[model samples]
Target: MNGSKISFLAFGELVVRQLTDFSNNAFAALILLIQDARTPMAVSSGGDDIMQSHES
Candidate 1:
């Protein structure tokens, strides 16, 4: 593969890894809050659960 092609693939891989890390961290935090008897709150950009909160 060309150098440019390899660079693009590496960039894409980094993006995917970052996203996976973020998701794992978010879920871990939620679990910790639940175990501590705190509210499992999450602030997402957009999702069905975000719109269907009891506060609304």
Candidate 2:
């Protein structure tokens, strides 16, 4: 019984650790996605300006 309890606790700890890591990675990816989204908008606007200048 004691051995089974110890194993169960270890499994729970591993699950918690994995969940923490997953959440951290997910947060980092979200931040990166937001930055990427902002960058494309800025770049597109800048590109349009360049195109207009060339046309004129």
Candidate 3:
């Protein structure tokens, strides 16, 4: 391929790599968000369970 075509291909490759990295980071962030949400709920429910057992 000529110089311009090679450069265009390289640019396209860079864009694809960047998009892949972004998607991976976004997925990781989503997982962290889900874990964070679940942690609070789990802790609250556990605490409630303990409190109920103590009351009884």
Q: What is the C-alpha lDDT of each candidate?
A: 0.77, 0.88, 0.87
Measured against the true structure, the TM-scores of the candidates, in listed sequence, are: 0.59, 0.69, 0.69
The candidate, 1 or 3, that scores higher on lDDT is: 3
lDDT tens digits, residues 7-48, model 3?
999999999999999999999999988887877646567877
- Give the least accurate 10-residue stretch of model 3, judged by summed lDDT: 39-48
C-alpha positional error of residue 55 in candidate 1 after TM-score superposition, expressed in Å: 30
What lDDT does model 3 reach? 0.87
| Ranking of predictions according to TM-score | 3, 2, 1
Clashes of each: 0, 0, 0
Local error of candidate 3 at residue 50 (angstroms): 15
Model 2 scores a TM of: 0.69
For model 1, how does the per-residue alpha-carbon lDDT over 3-38 read when each residue is reduced to its tens digit? 999999999999999999999999999887776554
